[model samples]
Every structure is written in structure tokens, then in C-alpha cells.
Target: MVKYLDTPGGFVTKAAASLTLDAGCEFGGGVDCGSQYFLGFMAYHRAWFLQDRLALTVGGGAITNPGRYLVLLPPINGTTAASGTPYFTANPGDRYRAWDFQVAADVIPRPFITFRVEFNHRAANVPYFSGPGGVTPPGGNQGAPGSLVDGWSPDLVKTENRLTGALMVKL
Candidate 1:
């Protein structure tokens, strides 16, 4: 969640990310769970031989849930079927791990402004991120409270690539 720039001769620059995952646990008739993981990288900015004042940063991060739990049910539910039953899922577990890498460039045109482009790759063993179809319910508002909507499965893929651009202004 934070970025660090090292001294010209400080040997390395540091970049880090924060990851969190929660696996529900059963207690009496209730369940509870949560997890957190992170990855970081160190780099030297003196390797940009093609461009002047262009900074390149490379980093990798991980996602993991090293908890003991099962399908997480609502802490409190007033449904007619049961009070602590969890929703249905074909594949449900309390453990998972994922990894990602990013390569970003900062084109510093001035002291107060910079144009940035980043390329990232992520790979996971479980369902993560939105696919061609997003996570939102289709067609919006299927019905009112307690009404069942048409069942639909999301397109959960294993690998994803993302390209992003940003215009940063620092005062």
C-alpha cells in the first residue's frame, strides 16, 4: 500500500502490496474467519538506459488464506430455512494462494506531474477478479426482498492481464 524511493546509491528501492483473505469457521452454530498476506520487491532505478528521467519499477505480491475454516455463513440470518446456513457453492474451501507481478514506468515530465503506464499479470488457483461478465447481478434488481433470482454462474478464470494509465499531479 506504500511506495519507497531509495537513495541513488542506497542499493534498492522498495515496493509493497497488501493482501487479505478470510475463511469462515464454525463455532457452536455460527462461523467466523479472516486472513491477510502481502508481497514486496526491491529494485534499482539506474537501469533505464533508453530514456532520460524515466523510472521503472518491478514488483511481485502474493495472496493467501492460511486459516482453518469452511464455507462462511452469515453471522446472523433470519431466513426461514435456517439461521446459520451458508449459501451454496460448488467449490468451497478455507485455503487459497495467488501471485501477481507488475512492471510500471513513470515518465516524469516535470517535478509536479508524471504520466504512468503499468502492465500487470495475475495468476490464481481459485476464482478471482471479474471476467468477461462482471460480478453484479444481471439486468439489475431481479426482485424484491426474499425473492430468488435466476441462478447464474460467474466466469472465473485463472490468469489475467491488465494495462492501466494514470496522470499523477503532486503538489
Candidate 2:
């Protein structure tokens, strides 16, 4: 279940929880028998000043998954959710945990337009995020779509920090 609420004072809150039950499969198909659960929560507060021309937002969230069933697999060598890669696999009982904090400042020149800059810091218990080398292999993909090459591997890290800027327009 998931819930979101908009409270007074320009605050927004979100919470989510989920349960997944998988029965063991026959003929080596499907997920193993186990129960997986996830919980997450986040709160954001936005305050505007200078007669609503400038706004700032700050928020952070954390999540935990014991089985890593809902975690997103990095696209190494053009891997997809359906076509999983051999380099890494999230089996049953594997844990995946992550949290992120972000802050954004926006310049609202007009009601329909916004110029924003954001900075985020995210971390995980394991090497899950892409690193400086990125998740791609050398010389692009080879052999099978997501199959391992001769001696190349994806670059994954445990933490990530990024700054981004964007222009948003509403019509």
C-alpha cells in the first residue's frame, strides 16, 4: 500500500509498504518460496520567498528489501528486466537497501515556467549504483545482448552524488 498527503505549510509526505509472496517453482522456473517486504517513507517541504519568485525544496527517503525483488538491476551491456545479465543476479535472500537525500532550488519567473537545480546524495549497503566507468562494457556490447564478454564487467559503486539542472514548463 502507498499513501501520499499534502499538509499545510507547503509540506508533502509519502509512505509505502509492500508484501510479495512467491511459491517455489517447478522445472526451474519462477521465484523461490519466500515472503519479501518493503517499507519506505519520505517528506518534502517547499518554501517560497521573494513574492513567490524563488522556492526551495528538501526531502529524503529510505527503503529496505530483504530479497531484492523490487530493486532495479543496472543496465550492464544492454541488459533488460526480461533479459537479465549474467554478471549480476539478485537471488532470493539477497538484501538491497538504499536511501537518498535531495535539495532543489527553483526560480519561478512565471507561473508556468521554472528553472531548477538539484543535488542528490544516495547510498546503498552493496555496490548498486554506477561508478565513474559506468555500467557499459568496452567496445560496446558483444555476443549475446546481456551476456558476459571475455573479461569485461560493469562498474558499480555503493554511493552516488550528483547535481542536475533542468527547465520545467507547464502548459
lDDT of 2 at 90: 65
Q: TM-scores of the models, in the given order?
A: 0.56, 0.78
- Give the number of the best model, judged by lDDT: 2
lDDT of 2 by residue, 73-162 (tens): 788888888888776676766777788998999988998999999999999999888899887778787776678877778889999999
Lowest-sum lDDT 10-residue window in model 1: 71-80
Candidate 2, superposed: residue stretches over 4 Å from native: 1-35
Per-residue CA lDDT of candidate 1, range 33-107, in tens?
A: 324222232322222322334667676665454331222322211212233222222122445566788888887
Superposed model 1: Cα runs more than 4 Å off: 1-52, 67-93, 141-148
Enumerate residue pairs that collide in model 1. none
Question: For each candidate, C-alpha RMSD in Å?
Answer: 7.9, 6.0
Report the CA-based lDDT of candidate 1 relative to the real structure.
Answer: 0.49
Clashes of 2: 0
Task: For candidate 2, report its TM-score.
Answer: 0.78
